[model samples]
Target: MDTALIVTVVVALTAWVFLLRSSMISMIWGPVVRSAGGDAVWAAVTSVVLYIAGLAAFALVVLAVHWALGGLPARALVLVLSALYAPVAFMPAPDRGARPYEDVRRALVRAGATEEQARACAWATGPLAFAGLAVVGGAVISVFAG
Candidate 1:
């Protein structure tokens, strides 16, 4: 509600959106686009628009959580969410044959990365990276928010 908190939320959400978009493009869509001989510019533009929309929706959720929790510090909320996500995010993919996993791996491989590299990239750019960002960002925000 205060100026400091508003500032913090804006900065945090912006960073989150940036990281998400970058990972999505580089590790996911970029490969697909390249393999399909699509226009990178158009893909980038569409991705940015979609990501910004997602950012707006996520911002509303963050605000709603802040209010619903009776002014719980956003930093604390972030930390809690990150903690909850860690197990699920870090867990090995249950099935390599799953559509999403196979598609991502295939894309990366088609983009000229080796099988091992594709696997690593898929894991890195997926939930693991986002959850890690949340944890680290939350910790840093806590230090300053406190």
Candidate 2:
């Protein structure tokens, strides 16, 4: 219903998907490929379904923010949304590994994650790192916001 909310949601969602693309695409693609014995059609269907689900969740987050905050002015709403997502969109260290931290990665390898599975878990770092940063950022903002 609100234009700014709409824009912010669309942009933030786009950024999230872009940020998640490489690894997650691999993740979704892997299963269907295996289960259907490398069926391109099944892989495509699975990918589409998963993507739509992710987008829906992003929409829900925006709606929740709107309802919880009562109605931020468009500018302010956009600012808050940016604050929430920017850290995720632009990670501080591009070269740094995304997840399973160094120790975790080693442990995963030791535990028998198959090279591919271990790599996938390592990619989990991308989302995990961003989610961690977002939570911390939100906490900092909350302290200042109040």
Question: How large is the C-alpha RMSD of every model relative to the true structure?
Answer: 11.9, 11.6
Candidate number with greatest lDDT = 1
TM-score, structure 1 vs. true: 0.35
lDDT of 2 at 69: 68
- lDDT (10s digit) by residue, model 1, range 1-146: 37787577556654554445434435544444444344444433443344344434544555565566633466567555533333323222223475545655565556555565555545544443454455445444542463
Cα lDDT, model 1, residue 34: 48
Model 2, span 59-136: residue lDDT tens = 456556545664345335645664454443322112444543443334334543344543444444334445434543
The C-alpha lDDT values of all candidates are 0.47, 0.44
C-alpha displacement of 142 in model 2, angstroms? 19
User: Candidate 1 — worst ten consecutive residues by lDDT sum?
Assistant: 86-95
